[model samples]
Target: MPKQIRIGTGAGYSGDRIVPAVKLAEFGDLDYLVFECLAERTIALAQQRKLSDPSKGYDPLLEKRMRKILGPCAENKTRIITNMGAANPEAAYAKVVELIEEMDLAHQKVGLVTGDDILEYLEAEDFPLSKGREKILANRDKIISANAYLGAEPIIRLLKEKADIIITGRSCDSSLFLAPMMFGFEMKEDEIERIGKGIAVAHLMECGAQVTGGYFADPGYKDVSGLADLGFPIAEVNVNGDAVITKLSDSGGEVSLRTVKEQLLYEVHDPANYITADGIADFTKIRLEEIGKNRVKVSGGGGKTQPNELKVSIGFNNGFIGEAQISYGGEGAEKRAKLAAQILMERLRILNLKFEGLRFDFIGAGSLWPGGSPSHIPKEIRLRVVGRTKTRHDAEGLCNEVEALYTNGPAGGGGVSRKVKENIAIVSSFIPREKVIPQTKTLEVENGSG
Candidate 1:
């Protein structure tokens, strides 16, 4: 079709900044703008919200983000792709439709990819816990959500159907970029090397600003300018599956070899084999060339056959975490904080409260480097006590003990703060490829008319 395609990364995570995405939509001249907004535990939290309100499981910022970029994206004919649907793709699709109607962008068409959720099909016995292969049935009552990581097949199908916007739940992050390449270049499933090259491009761009010097900046050794106005990444991929990583010319950020290398190694367990739902990418052979001031050409990635099974992330209620913090200042702050911690322990013991676990940290005195000698004692230190418990009552007791330290034992104990929250734990398991049946749905408006 076209000689090359430009894909811009909009959002890297669920809570990423919105301004960069808006900028991309307005001026990037991208063929596709992808938002990778789902994380391992985000869907689980969204599921909890869905249980409370049937129509609100998707990313909370979906509406705001869509409202900001939808009009510009539709005007520019830059198709949108996002996994922001989170736990509810249908509801997300409906919301997008409403936004389109409200914005009167009837020229745009929306599509949703579904069936990644397999909570109903999963039997606790069939899929054991990922950590120890423990039977999932043990925590059946607490399980909140289970979603499989779909690949690019369904997205490719949607593109073939000419869907302008595609929403999904838990699709592979790289697949968002790969789908367009596969569709635009007419690449077949068996094209392993080409697919791998595409995957390499996706992995590099998936984290948005990470490739553009956001996370890779170190003050003295490696430095990036204009951090506050950093631009998201854009990949100009060719039919051959090679790509050049760059950003908007007027944007602020550096796309250098150091930044690209750091991002390439991020979250990669093995350089030779980076696994995903679609296929296993061999990044060992990937080569990067600094083609311009803010452009790097990438090629030489290889791919193996797709995995026989797909990994699924399962979320369950792990219990509750109770935490409280109190600050001590003026000479001997460390001693006072330690005394406060001791008093908390003694109080918990007196109350005969049995917590699953407990931890005490002295913020100003080597909490991060535990047991390491501090060069000097600070004038101020904060004592933070946290505990995990099976029930809310037990958790509340832990927090209350820390709060009571102000009046009962410690001197100059101020800035007392306490919080209790339900802990959503995650586990992973795999299922046969045949088990997941991904389908697509389309919604369109005719010539700015609903």
Candidate 2:
């Protein structure tokens, strides 16, 4: 039988937060650490990185964290897997290998699973990942960023080699720890459902303290003590993969049924089916018990048939969008903002310049001037108008026209600043599992002498 495993994750991770996770892992004595650093904006950042340097795809912060954690884990005999390689995992691993050598860490090997990014193949045949986002893709010929979410099997393969650390692009967040458990226990295929339970455990802990009173808290933990040093949640998983969610010893946070329930609802659209790269998990049948203080016992969960269509994120050139705010004073201030936005869009329409989208909103007025909520507080209102077009020139044109709304028509137009924020196009695309099959290859690395 394999030894009982403990997995912990730091507070919600971005490119900038991976460092702290590594530092925590160094001192926490965890068997495995999983890091999530990819977001919608992360893809954009990766694309933007390519413009200045070819080796600029992965988040440098993630790389730095790996550098901090890699040697320490190997010394302590712990393993780690993280999805910090947003666009390029192999390249990121190469950087890690370079760091290991530079730091003079002996016998340290890093493995990376690639072929997850389908950008090149998807870009072929002029399938420009920008077709749908005309407004953000103005004049851009192709998508600035594209990455596919990979599953856990590849990471399992890497761990088999005792590589010490594994990195890759978008992956089912739960898979990071699941791969370690599966490899460590030599679990069989028939037991995968129980593994699914462990995956759920990982999901709850993936966002760090999220499942431990970060977002959901009882009266006792309402203030969220030790927020700056709030330790990550841990999963004490068994050979069968059943687990309890808790935090490491001496950690600050609370984990209970309510906390687990709070995390179950995070980023979920339906309680019956939550999709992941590995499989689908149903939170509806989940049973939670307040096993102990800062601990929750989970069981009686269910899952569904995994979807055949893999969700692919593709960002292409969406033309451009610009908005300005105008403040109004007095009784009808809120109404003025709304009307101002509408009139600005209408005026742009009269100019005969086609735009992909437009939106107008009032800052404050009778709970948006229709459904008046109780406790009305007098507040200044702002009218804002946004426009998107296929060409930057056209987008700028809309910006120019909307800015003119202040002097030409409605009063109280104030923050009319025409500034270009992001220049590339953004497009979202989805590829069926069949089309993505080609990019799902895995490699094996041997760890110790056989």
Candidate 3:
């Protein structure tokens, strides 16, 4: 018999449901509940939020989530880890401390991982940007955010110090789970194969419900029951790096080999040479077995050392996208929808909206596979038009034209909704790992912000 640890995936994305996390904290008996919330788009939006107001940059749902799960997590002694800090970990730290005091929960220690924001340093270094980002570098002022993908070392340090909840900014998703494994198993960095196994496990669990059947439901092919009450995944791992991916038995959804395999390959470019901040995992060598109804045993994950350079996600002000959708329900809905699209295109030229690019999508039609002729005529069709413009004003004008179409023409154009969104472009660049130093700040409620 060897030592084992349970780590639960709380969130898969920034706007993921909270009830699943509450379930994990209350009944999953997890030693750690990690929320992987930072994506390139989310990190960019958070940076914009910080730019608007210095005190308001972290994840919008951070307060709501902390309020709900903090109680159960404290009661069950489940440590929480999240990269909800996004653009500002220090401010996130302050806010969490405030919550701790207001809630008056016994959860005392809170740790913040910082020094990931390498904007100034990146600018000074002028490192070679990835994927034509060097071209975008000419418009340097438009760059909204630049954060390095930090590894598990800082988090491991925080865990050893007994931090109740750790907040991070733009950390590697798998690194969030890797830190706990490395700490619990007392695994060293030089231990290559074990580290790779840990990375493989984290990759599968980081997406939360994806490994449990949230995104695997098909009508008749792969019908997954109790989707309304889908449960998040929990990893039971041993010192040998062997893991069992499962969900609460009483909870909804299935965790068979299909679900596990689907998630394992999700967003993975190279199964054989999957790269991460922790180790280069060889997912090809990984093996999965369905030992039970809702349990899949995972083992035989191989790996190599971490890359010398760390990939940095950079977000910049791309443009504004104005989108408007209107529905048509009748015998000849498809015909009317196409006509509406034509009318909008003509109106755009008349108004001189100055769109950089424009696209028309006819929902319930061939929007997904454009240029393909579809003979099946849909009774109800929704016309969706989106245009990209240089300025927000022009973007608003584009949407306004769609709204105007309702009263002018396109009879039966109902449920017209229009909105303008800031278009943020995310790019990646690499920097020497040694240049980006990750520091941790542990604070307590009674200490009044340390």
Candidate 4:
């Protein structure tokens, strides 16, 4: 029999349900449990938090997640890999140590992958933002974070060192899984085709429950059962990088050919040339077969060698978005909602409040679909007014106008609510691979000998 490793996804995003992760850690007999929780703006928000309090920049749920799954992982002898470090891997590393000491799992070793933060690199070099030659020097003050999408080489090094728990900041999401596959299979860095095959498996498993029918639900056309207790995904990958995408037999979600195929094409712009930190994978040639119920065998992927330049995500302050909503019901609700929106717009105009951006949506009255779909007129409707501005004062000025509609402008404009939120924008640029030198260090466990 060919050697293989069973890897499971615990949490897909920062706010994913913890119960599924606990289930995955406990019941998904596995070699590694990966939690991919960093979105593009997530690390930027974390960087903001870090600026306010140096020790508080990691994921808020990191402590809770570690407490829940650490013991199960130790019991199953399965290692943990995650990018929950967000903007602060060292602080996250310290927190994990504190948890292990408290839980008395002193033999468990944790490691950190560093050097993803490339703000210093950007400052040293005047790089453009994305495709445009617009230099970043003008908006340098607004930048919160600049992190490179690191590949699996650093992670593979940590796995070789036998770190039971791995923490990283802004790693390429799929690289979290590819690192283990490469290490477990002893696949070298120069093996581009083999690496591409591994990338195919990594991309499928990166989104956690996404591959297990969580996002594959359509009411009549594509119904997925038991979504209330939807189970996460587990990929069984062999030496040749062939994989079987599956879930627990008793788990809620299904892993049919449809789900696997959907996730393969998810976010893939060019099916023949999907780019990543590791290499460019070709999804056009991937073969998918439903060998058994909820078990799909995936293989046959091709690709080009890894890119010479690595992409870096730049997070910056992008002003504020202010929003307010009011509802109207019973008799001509759509008209009432539209009239209320009109009132807010005219009111803001009279107040001489200028906004960077503004929008008025008459929800339940063809807001989602423009030019109007022929659905029955809603018995009730909601009017939402949103504005984006540079200052919080302007943002609040935009929301206050909507609240005034309750009494000053429209009748039955009840259930009024408003909010103002800071918007963190994300942009990308590229840097040479040689510039992003990742380093890994193992955290020492405390009091192991009994």
Model 2 lDDT per residue over 1-450, tens place = 566787767435663345446555777667887777776657666766766877867876765676677667767777667777777666677677667666666566577877667766665734433235354234345566666666667787777766676777877677776677777788643464665676677778778778766665445646566555555777887766668888755666667777788787788887767787666877777788887887788777756545566666766655566655567777766666667766776777787877677666555644366666335754676666566766677767767776777687566656665653444544555556655532223333333431
For each candidate, the alpha-carbon lDDT, in order, equals: 0.89, 0.66, 0.89, 0.88
Q: TM per model? A: 0.96, 0.79, 0.96, 0.97
Estimate, for each residue in 1-450, the C-alpha lDDT of model 4 and write its tens digit.
339999999888998889888888889899999999999899999998999999988999999999999989988988999999999999999999889988887488899998998888677777633443264556778888999999999999999999999999989998999999999989887787788888998899988889998888999999989899988889999888889999988879889989998999988899989898999998888899999998999989978889988888888898999999889998888888888877777888898887988998888777787966347878888888889999899889988888888778667888989999999988778888888889999976865551
Between the candidate structures 2 and 3, which one is better when assessed by lDDT? 3
Per-prediction CA RMSD (Å): 1.8, 5.3, 2.2, 1.6
Q: Cα deviation of 6 in candidate 2 (Å)?
A: 1.4
Evaluated at residue 256, the lDDT of candidate 1 is: 89
- Candidate 3 Cα misplacement greater than 4 A, ranges: 127-133, 371-375, 446-450
Better of 2 and 4 by lDDT: 4
Candidate 3 per-residue C-alpha lDDT over 48-166 given as tens digits, one digit per residue, 9 for 90 to 100: 89989999899999999999998899889899999999998899889998998888887479999998998888688775544556665787888888899999999999999999999
**CA displacement after TM-score superposition, residue 95 of candidate 1 (Å):** 0.5
Consecutive 10-residue window with the lowest summed lDDT within model 1: 124-133
Task: Point out the worst 10-residue segment of candidate 2 by lDDT.
Answer: 438-447
Which residue pairs clash within candidate 3?
none
Which ranges in model 4 have alpha carbons more than 4 Å from their true place?
128-130, 133-135, 448-450
Ranking by TM-score: 4, 1, 3, 2
lDDT at position 377, candidate 3? 70
